[model samples]
Target: MAHPISFLKGVCCGAGLMYFMDPERGRRRRSLLRDQCVHYCHKATRAAEVVRRDAQNRLQGTVAEFRHAFQHDEPADDVLTARVRAKIGRYVSHPSAIDVDASGGRITMFGSVLARELDGLLAAVRSVRGVGEVQSALRVHDDAGATPDLQGGVERRGERYDLMQEYWSPTSRSVLGAAGLGLMATCLGRRTPSSMLLGTLGLMLTSRAMTNLDTFKLLGLGGRRRGINVQTGLVINAPIEKVFELLSDPQNYSRLSDSIESVEDLGDGRYHKTVRLPGGAEAMLSERIVSVQPNELVRWRSEPDSFVPYAGAAWFNKLDDNRTEVQVCMSYNPPGGVFSHLAASAAHMNPKMLMDEVLMRTKQHLEGSQPSREEGGERTGAAASTGGHPAGSEPQGSPRVEGASSPAQAGEPVIHNL
Candidate 1:
């Protein structure tokens, strides 16, 4: 059998040709209807794609905005909930309901929240890192106000919330997690049914117990003391020595990082540096050069405060040609260990995520031409100390290194074999 679409296209083309050849009004009229239908279908498909893309973009933005608004609160209840409700209300055919419970610290909504909209809501709810759960007791409704009666039903709906009750339900997460562990154990078949069941139950209990234990011990955890470490490569078109020279100069840091406000060389390879934060807060950080071996390696330790302790080090390995691999590693002990971990989870502060950013900027700095740099004029004190003794060579019992470098000194940038 012939393809129906192909046959229709052929018939339309033949009829068009016959009309043009004979100048018959009837033939032309038939051709025009077919052409119009095809054109309209194409336009409809394009329109649908545009609508889909726009919807996706809006959803992503909503999720991001909601997450930003609720990053810290548990069972978050704030303007974000209202904002989301408004956004969702726009799409639903029903008037939405939002209930904010300050006493219980929860936000609940109901009334015609669709399946697709659930993702945005869930994402917003989960963005609050410590949020225990997101209870989506939302339902979809099809009542759209006035019928544009083409094919689908028109209905309006909304959602309901219970602020007094917990927004997150741990029971559901536990069940799913336990099920996953049980399935894994069954596939392994390492033990008898009774033993397997007991083991799985024990695992689940242990997991929950550990989480509870952490919750109790949050304040004592060394979360604030520990920090993240990152390493990234920067390949300069110039010689490795040139790159090392530029890196060793404390004044160049501002060029490497837009965040650096100033660099005061103290002597040796150390400097007192100031950095501007996102909200215009200037942080005066005491950074000591822990190690410096010409262009081979340079490491530093930064303690923003007595509580925010972090150490970062990097080793420069020169690959053949102009490329260099800078290996960076950081160690941090967050304050209060696990207890204050939640407080430190915010971006621009987290050790792990911050390390990534540092690496990325480091790469950008070395790769790009020097931008603006603060004056690294004369030092009021002795030569700024190096970041610390060259990494592995730091005396076992020596104090942690922190310092900056002067702008005048140029050093070779080659990895020296131990």
Candidate 2:
């Protein structure tokens, strides 16, 4: 009687009974639950299968890596040198600075190598089979120390291809994703503490595996190197000057989208913005106006100390007299990680999607042919140009996203070229 969990269980049972016994929609709800269970069971069975039989492009490297176990014969000298060089480049930042040579199955590496990298390079070279001996004819420097050869070089173009390092390979994804799905399927709807904990962990792991992002990046804990970009644009039924003026100021953001609560101008080209987050929460960010070119473009970024960091830019293109293409590009470390994005996307809460929505509203507002924008241009068919939307009605036009890198330039780490 005194146990809180017991009380919670009783309450949950009562609620479930009430829910399933409802006269109106209980049957539908029960049927939906049954269908979901069957679906999840099938998924769990597949997850438990470990790896698929067919080789996949993403899994090619992992498959090849395992082949070394069966490889007993030594490769030719040139092939061995290529293998060592390929393997060693990923372990060091400056690979080109190091020279690789192999003769009679022996490797001789000679170049200006970093002192810290020497051990790793040597070990990696020794890992290759058919190597008789290794000779180091290299000048090792403790630090870059103005060393030309050891300075300003990165690992050869293989690290990005190798998902086994900092990134997850297809094999890792298959195993981990299956485990997560299987766990969640088993724990679904269980109210016990351990069950809930496991369910949460399963969800996190599944999201991580599905997104190929580490936990730090998912939580926005500063792993946002070369951030995700959303670039999309659409033509608005308004003059270039009118559209440009509206977007030139941050205050107009709220006018274009209902999701924006408010944007307060705080003088000196800065603003305080309040936006609705996923799940009906709100966040405030301090923003800096990086640059502005009238009737051309505007760029902005969140302050470093702000709780949420983001950068964006909008470009105005004149298309004849009464229409303009508004190209918007937003790049940011997605806050709350990949799962949050998946959820938000399901709910239509994606930021890029919002851009389209707001512009539609802005287009509607402009289509009304506000008196200010119509300086004696006389009567034109407003509804005809904008499609027939009743006056004061909401806009329903869809905005198109570029899906390419953003064009607006932002500060380091976040600013990627278009």
Candidate 3:
């Protein structure tokens, strides 16, 4: 089966090359190839520069470490402790909250502090003189309140999403995109079946990389989401009211995703939804509409009885009389820990993909187009509602209410499962 698929793909590529290299169109194709080559070359140069700089920094650090070890013995216990404390204090805004202790070249940090502050505190302590090992006994806290365990470390709500974005930022995309393009160009220039096969692989990679979609999880280049946040957006050629109406109905969900087996309305803006996962497994969720501003915004959160804790919001902006931009954002903590996150990320089954497909289907359905098989049929019930403006009116802006998650920005990468 795999061999046949590979053969067909090769044949398709050969045919595409013959067409693109036709006498009349060959010049244009050649020009495109040249442009792509130049673009990729520049990207390669930038990447090389980054690598060189990083290598130099690492080398310098190593040299400095060796020099220090040779020149000075470990400092006295009290002196080392003072130095470690000062180092930790410099990195944190609220040093008073942190209590640092040093004994036998080991340092222990005890305090109630924000999660983001932990990494720096540990690093700083390790860099101090006479510090052999660092132990973090600190209690971490976020806006949500106190947390006792600091083992996995607490991350800010969207830290994973932010990291993923930085990883696949425009610059990173360009570099990968150029590599893909270069491969295709090489195949075209070579004009051989073997080259075509390689080009096909390149094309696949390029398509995935250029779209800001993280499809190469097997290679570990895919985005990572943390602490339950997913944001995605799409533009629709319909008024805000019509789009909002379509999304508010729970029935439309099945049309967007086949995974959604059923949605049951539980009244008072609450719903019980059953979902079929990839392996015939099923999970149920209880959700309630927390906020609604007609045609402008809608938000929902998981009920206490839900398996996964989650919150989400959608925002509608009128781009024009015939076009509206819709944004959806979701944040959830998956049931299991790191292993579950790895599985979901590797499978590309994260919430960002879910919202992406949903928004795409919503666009298609509202525009009277048939939803793709990859996307499913519409399910029924209202998931959320906002009470601000009428359709097509200028939104006063999202409400100042507490607990409302922000809508996903277009092309923003979100962490999933983590």
Count of steric clashes across candidates, in order: 63, 4, 22
Compute the lDDT for candidate 2: 0.62
lDDT of 3 by residue, 1-418 (tens): 6599899999999997897789998887677668768976996677566646655776798799888876655677788878876675566655666787777788887887776777877776777767889888987775324443333332332223422552454434555668889999999999799999989887865755543434433233322222434566789998877787767655455445444566777778787877656566667777788888888988887777766566778888999888999887765556443334445655555566567656765666667664334223343211211111111111234211111111221222232211
lDDT of 3: 0.60
lDDT of 1 by residue, 1-418 (tens): 5699999999999986786666557675576568768976996576456546655776798799787675655444555455555654434433333332322334455434444445655565544334444555565434333433212423423343321221212332334446656755664676777767767665544343223323222233443422322233434454567556655545544433334455665666555665444345554556667677897877776544423455666666778667766565555444453323334343223333333333344444555533343465432211111122112222333322222232211111111110
- The positional error of residue 195 in candidate 3, measured at the CA in angstroms, is 41
What CA root-mean-square deviation does each model show from the true structure?
29.9, 11.0, 12.9
Q: Where does the lowest 10-residue lDDT sum fall in candidate 2?
A: 381-390
Residue-level lDDT of model 2, residues 276-390, one tens digit each, is 6655566666678888898998887776655456677888999899999998776666556554455555554565666665466566666663223323332211100000001
* Residue 226, model 3: Cα distance from true site in angstroms: 6.9
Q: Which stretch of 10 consecutive residues in model 3 shows the poorest summed lDDT?
A: 384-393
lDDT of each: 0.45, 0.62, 0.60
Give the Å error, residue 187, model 1: 32
List runs of model 3 lying over 4 Å from the truth. Answer: 1-226, 371-418
